[model samples]
Target: MTEFDILVVGEANPDLLLRGDVRPRFGQEEQLLTAADLVLGGSAAITAVGCATLGLRTALLAAVGDDFFGALVRDQLTTAGVRLMPYAAGGVPTGVTVILSEPDDRAMLTLPGTIAALRPQDVTDALIQSTRHVHVSALYLQPGLAGGLAEVFKRARSLGRTTSLDTNWDPSGAWASLDDILAHTDVFLPNAAELSAVTGAANPDTAAAQLVALGTTVVMKDGARGARAWWPDGEAAAPGRPVDVVDTTGAGDSFNAGFLAGRLGGHDLPESLRWATVAGSLSTRAAGGTAAQATRADLMP
Candidate 1:
C-alpha cells in the first residue's frame, strides 16, 4: 500500500504578519500598533500542514535553504505532523514573507529565495509512488517547477496517483504555461481572481468552464462566496461558512487540503466543497496560515 495520503510539492517560507495600523509611512519614523507574528507560511507548506491536521499522512517535498529560517521551516513542518523531505539547496538563503494584515485584505512582500527554487526534477519516482495524491502550489513563484510540472503530474497519473495544482498568483501577470499542465492535472484549484487571470475569462464561471473543457476538474475558491467545482462527470458548489475573519493568509491552501482530504476519504463533490469552505473559513481565525487550521472534529463537530 502507498504510505502517504498526500504529497505537497512547492514553496517553504516563514511569514511575518503585522496587524493594526500597518500602513507604511516612509518618513523615517518607527510605528507599530497591535500584533506581529512570525509563523509558518508558503502555500504548499500550509496545505501540507492542513492535510496532516485533517488526519492525512502528509509529506512536503520542497527546497529550504540551510539557514535559520530553513531550520525554522523544518521545525514547523515536523511539529505540524507533515514529513519534510528537504531538497539539497547548497546553502542558499531561506525565503520569507512579510505581511501587512487586515480583516478584509492583506499585502505581502516576499523574498523568493528558496521558495522560487524548487524544481520538477526533484519530485522523485519514489515520492510519486509512495503517495496516493500529489498536490503542487505556488507555481507562479516556482518558475523552475512551473516549466516541468506537466511531466511530473503525467508520471503520477500513470502510477494511479491523482494530481492537483494551485498556481497561487502570477505576479508578472503573464500566466503562461498552463495548457499542458492542466492536461495532466486531475484537479486545478484557483481563486476567482486567479482563475480569471489564468484563463483570461470574463468571469470565474467562464474560467471554470474553460478549464473544465480542458479535461481537468476545476475547483474555484470564490472567497466569501465559498468554493465551486466543475468536473467532467458533474458540478457542485458550497456557500461560505460565516465567520469573523482574522487573517486570510493561507486560507485557500487550507481549502485545498480540505477538498483533497475529503475526496481521498471518498466524499462526494458537494460535501467536499463544504469541507473546503469550512476549513478555509476556520483558518482565518488566526494570524498565520496554519495556526487556526481545522481538524476533522472541528469540521464535523
Candidate 2:
C-alpha cells in the first residue's frame, strides 16, 4: 500500500510580492507606491501545497537552508499540512523570489540560494517506495539534483509509481539530458512555450507529439487557449473556461495539481485536462500563487 499519494521533489522559497506596482525601468530606479505582500512560493512547494489543498496525502522532498527563510519554509509547509522529508544541506540561505506586480500582472526576480543546492539523494528510498506519484519541477535548473533525479524517476517507474514532470520555463534551456529524464516521465506538463522550446518544434501539437514519441504522456498548456493532451491513440484539447483573471502566478501549478488529482481519481485524459484547466483558470482569480487553487469539494466528478 502506498503511504503517500504524492511526493513533490523540488525547491521551496519565500516570496516577496509587491502588488499595484509602477513599472521599474531599466537604468532608472522606481519607488514603491504601495504595500507589498509576502507569501511562500517555490515550484515544488507550491505543487505540494496545491496537492495537499486538494486532499492528497502529499510529502515534500526538498532542501532548505538552516536560516530564517528555512524557518519560514517549514512554517508554510506545516500550515499547508504537507509532510516534510529530512532536508539535506545546512547553513545555506533558503531561496527567495521578489515579485513586482502591477494591478494587471507581475514580474519575478529570483534568488536561487539554497534551492540550487538540492540533490537527488534528498529523495530517499523510503519516500520513493511509499509514494504512488512523484512530481518534479524545473528539471533543467539544478545541477546537483539532476543525476539523483534520474535515478529517482527510474526507481519510481520500476516501482509502478506514476511520475509527472513539470518542465517549467527554462530560459537558457539549461539541462542537457532532457531526453533521459523524459524516458521515466509517465506524464509531462509543460506550457506551450516550454513544449516548443524543449522539443524545438514549430507548434504546440508538433511539440506534444514529439514528446509522446520520447515515451511519455504530454499535457500542453496554452494560457488562454486552454490545454491539450497527446497520447498514442489520439489527441484531446480542452478549451479554457471563461473566468476573471487576477494573477497568473500559480495557474500552472494548480493545473498540474488538478490534473494529477483527476488522474488519481481514475478520470480519463480528456476529463483530466478539463479538470486541470478549470483549476488553473480559477487560480488566476486571486493574487498569490495558491490563492485560487481548488479544494476537493471545489472539484467534483
Question: TM-score for each prediction?
Answer: 0.97, 0.94
In terms of TM-score, how similar is model 2 to the real structure?
0.94
- With a 3 Å backbone cut-off (N, CA, C), the pairs that clash in candidate 2 are none
1-301, model 1: which lDDT tens digit per residue?
8899999999889999899998899989888869999999999999999999999999999889989999999999999898998578887799999999888888999999888787788998999999999999999998898889999999999999999999998888898959999999989999988888888886767788888888999999999999888998889889888888888999999999999999999998888889999999999987899989999987772
For model 2, the superposed segments whose C-alpha errors exceed 4 Å read 26-28, 103-105, 173-177
Candidate 2 residue lDDT tens string, 182-218: 8888999989878877888878777777778888999
Candidate 1 ranges beyond 4 A from true positions: none
Give the candidate number with the greatest lDDT: 1
Lowest lDDT sum, 10 consecutive residues, model 2, at 169-178
Clashing pairs in 1: none
What is the number of backbone collisions in each predicted candidate, taken in the order shown?
0, 0
Residue 97's lDDT within candidate 1 is 96
